[model samples]
Target: MAAYQDTFTSIPLSELATLAQSKKDEGARFINIHAATVADGFVLTYTFTSNETVTDNCQVHVTADDVVPAISPLFLAAFVFENEVHDLFGINIEGIAVDFKGDFYQISIETPMAVPTKPEHATAVNTKYGATVPVKQRKGEEQ
Candidate 1:
């Protein structure tokens, strides 16, 4: 909580935790967890509406489609973040943590995350320039 309160850039949460511990060991009065929160499909933010000479608009946000994974030996808060990911994105972290059956996406045996995007030229209408692309690299890679 405290870290999120202070963090500007997104550090891997475990790294943040380690850094927090080092600061505490150096006799820090208190430690802050700079992790951030999100809501309404956007990562919660701390931002400046007006422009400044130098300060960037500070924000740390995570969306359901995006996730940062934990680092290891063991990060106590990592699982919690994983849970958050699952709660929001329907992912399973605990199972992955233990090398059990797990998938971030609800992948079925027949359709396991092989989704591909349509080619850019496939949908473009630049026939005046050319047929959007050379014929050699078209679908089926036909030359």
Candidate 2:
């Protein structure tokens, strides 16, 4: 087994772009980006490898209404993951080199991976992003 160290740093959305650029300049390769929908909102994780041995995770906590800055300006490959995250999690991502506008997968539901709620209360609970219709009902029933 290999010994590895992981560093996780929390950053504000405002400084995401700047810090990401700095990491690129330091010879870090963008590995992946992911998000998890929590009770309060979302926790975005940006993974990078400075080398084969060192990995860094830039974690950003955001509310349902927060808009995260895109890191494509520094790491172009990030756009792909960012688009997927946007579509699945519905976390707003601003300023990517290639923006998908939340249509990355063409699924019937928007933000399919978002935290789930009962279909009946989805309209009221998810007022910020519209209602969450059940997948089965999405085809023939009204939203």
Candidate 3:
């Protein structure tokens, strides 16, 4: 069996939607979009698959305040992932085809997966008792 390696390409946030469209034009199917909280902000990865075995990823680094352009205009299935990232990580994605306005999930806390940007915003978890608690108070975690 041949080994398949996924390729990741870093792209500017301004080119997110454009890149998605280009990938679609190149006969790639939109797979999914994922988000991870970083020290400075967030890293959002958009994945596409082509030729059944080749995977291409476009990564965009953005702060919480950065407004990400929604690609749902080109790929209708992207609305779900866009809403998920926005509701779960506090990413600011604009112009979604079907905008849920942060009501995608029934979670109590907003941006529960978001990394706190300030010292006063240290609380990163919500306890089962409906109380908020602070996790590790660090800018970035060492893996």
How do the predictions measure up, each by TM-score? 0.26, 0.79, 0.79
What tens-digit string does per-residue lDDT give for candidate 2 at 15-123? 8878887888888899989997666677899999887676789889887788888898789999998899888888888997899787678988777787465354354
Tally clashing residue pairs in candidate 1: 7
TM-score of 1: 0.26
Clashes of 2: 0
**Candidate 2, residue 31: how far the Cα is off, in Å:** 0.4
C-alpha lDDT score of every prediction, in listed order: 0.33, 0.80, 0.79
Q: Please give the clash total of every predicted structure, in order.
A: 7, 0, 0
Write down the lDDT that model 3 would get: 0.79
User: Please, what are the lDDT tens digits per residue for candidate 3 over residues 1-143?
Assistant: 45787999999988877787788798788889999866567799999887657788889998767899998888899999999998898788999999999999888877776645443344322211134454554658553
Pairs that clash in candidate 1: 2-33, 3-32, 3-33, 3-34, 4-33, 4-34, 4-35
Model 1 ranges with Cα > 4 A deviation: 1-40, 44-59, 72-74, 88-143
